[model samples]
Target: MSAIEASPAQQATVRMAARALGRAGLVHAYGHCSLRLNHDYLLVCAPMPPGLIQREAGVVVPIRGELPDGVLGEVRIHQQIYARRNDVGAVARSMPPSVMSLSTAGITPVPRHGPGTYFAPSAPLWDDVQLVRSTPQAEGVAETLGHARAVVMRGNGAVVVGATLEEAVAFTWFLEDAARVECAIRAMRLENASAMSAEDAARRATTAGRVIERMWDYLSAGDLELNSSHA
Candidate 1:
């Protein structure tokens, strides 16, 4: 439990995470990300390009799904997790190339690689990844992501959960970056045999998780205004 205050700086950091996700090649207009606010509401992407996601200033909605009618249809994707998972405070979804490729191959994305493994992240694959398919799918994801920070959608995409918006966005960016690294490392290993040691990987994950957590704390403390509701 580090000091995570809500302030403008925290919001900006969350915004930067969306931009980073795009820069890391985790954007598609269809993908989305969200941050839970005080267990009552959340702030999320505004149906724009990953790069523009931050520029548009994310939309705010109830943690209990009190959004206005006719908003992004995929919004339910997030609702699924929030309604069922009590531990998470934020959520993110992405259709990154490597992840999609893995999903298509039916192989799934596991945390064999990651940005830093900070935030106590774990990248598990879900069976039915489509968020809007059924109300139950989201619940299933929420269940899998129970207390963890990340889950990659099988044959679909990826989702990252956190204790705050900053942590969620950090997880999103880092996961995409890690996916890229994993894809490259995997290719190289297949070609030859070069690789990073398990010890190094574990060390990085632990360090990365803690760093993300602190940065998230700083960001949330700044973006106190973006909170959808005090609840």
Candidate 2:
């Protein structure tokens, strides 16, 4: 449903998704996310920083054209993807530190945790370090993304897409976890450090999708739920 037509609950879920991504360390103050409101439009958060996003902060806008005040300049990224990919329902752009680090280093993240299996064997890199503010740039990045779940923007961060909001959030979380593990391995200088095989990753992706809603429930509950689990 379009954000203009979304229920209070749906809009609230969108807000929660954004904040949860922030809490999971997938996004910082600068990045943005969007939900495909309908076939022709997406509901994107305002240009305000990530952690501060509220339910009312979203703006329903067309895929292209002069952006509304407070709309993100990089809404073009969300716009172009929604324009080109018929199956996509949600998109998230984040600047998680580890992911951005790997991007700058020209290293693609691989599955290190079981959740990491949700990603492709290697997330494609956009290579361009500029803000994705133009249609051609957005289309090129979307092309690099292809059918992959995620793509890394060199010197920027990563963008994840999904058939649903839950899946997008799941990918964002797993992407950062993979990056963290990759950085750890690199830090240790393991000459032959191995990542999960593509076959294993595919198998895990299937399993992860089945339980993604549960995982999202746990994650969205914040650290109190996590702390209680360890208590």
Question: Model 2: runs farther than 4 Å from truth?
Answer: 1-4, 64-66, 208-210, 222-231
Report the Cα lDDT for residue 208, model 1: 41
lDDT of 1 by residue, 103-191 (tens): 65555434444463532333666766455555555567767666666767776777777766566766666766666666766767765
Most TM-score-accurate candidate? 2
Candidate 2 achieves a global lDDT of 0.78
TM-score of each: 0.68, 0.88
Show how many residue pairs clash in every candidate, following the order shown: 19, 0
lDDT of every predicted structure (CA atoms):
0.60, 0.78
lDDT (C-alpha) at residue 221 in model 1: 49
For residue 214, what is the lDDT in candidate 1? 68
